[model samples]
Target: RVGEGVRGKVAVREGNGGRVLMMLATWPTEVSGDVVQSVDTLLAGVRPLPEPSVAVRATPRAPEPEPGDPR
Candidate 1:
């Protein structure tokens, strides 16, 4: 995971067999498209984390919007 001062954004998908795979990339607030591409390229080459006995996995995700959200 990227450390302090670098913020991450994520896009999540429900995988086969009910698993959840989250695509998380750390970038600056005003990040360009190239920066995002670079992060994606890096993530694609990585290995998975060690498996636990249970199926659950945890990763960063955006909080659900509150009722007062403008959208």
Candidate 2:
């Protein structure tokens, strides 16, 4: 239990490579509407963006002419 207003139970177990996996399967608690609102506000519209495009070069550009030289 985190506090008087919130009570939760978490189950943690070891996975492959000694990694811990925590599961909050059952967390029945009594919280005010304000608490729920605050949590929603904190994670409002949270999402993952698509990966960016990457440019590839197969050749170098030609050198530019000098200021006083002809093209």
Candidate 3:
């Protein structure tokens, strides 16, 4: 399940019959597209946090496939 909130977002993940994993994100005043890119970066295992001086005009990353997905 995926949900967007007033400032936060949450994605529910379930596996192995009863296990669950939840991914949540929040960004104040940032474009939804940018936030999505950040989430995709994280999910892709790219762990480098951007420097504060980096501008949003920087190239966005291509989205990665979800874990275990055939695509």
Instruction: Please provide TM-scores, in order, for all candidate models, with all chains considered together.
Output: 0.34, 0.31, 0.36
What's the TM for model 3? 0.36
Cα lDDT tens digits, model 3, 1-71, are: 23353365566655343655666766665467777677767755523344344567578887899999887
lDDT of 1 at 25: 71
Any runs in candidate 2 off by more than 4 Å, and if so which? Answer: 25-71
lDDT of 2 by residue, 2-71 (tens): 6654654455555444555555422236756666555555444333344344443245568999899878
Q: Which candidate comes out best when scored by TM-score?
A: 3
- Which candidate number maximizes lDDT? 1
- Look at candidate 2 and tell me the lDDT of residue 44: 47
Query: How many clashing pairs does model 2 include?
Result: 0
Worst 10 residues of 1 by lDDT: 46-55
What lDDT is obtained when candidate 1 is compared to the true structure? Answer: 0.67
Task: Tell me which of candidates 2 and 3 scores higher on lDDT.
Answer: 3
Off by over 4 Å in 1: 1-4, 28-33, 37-71
Candidate lDDT (C-alpha), each = 0.67, 0.52, 0.60
- Candidate 1 versus truth, CA RMSD in Å, comes to 15.9
Candidate 2: Cα lDDT at 42? 42
In candidate 3, which residue pairs get closer than 3 Å at backbone N, Cα or C atoms, i.e. clash?
none
Off by over 4 Å in 3: 1-6, 40-71
TM-score of 1: 0.34
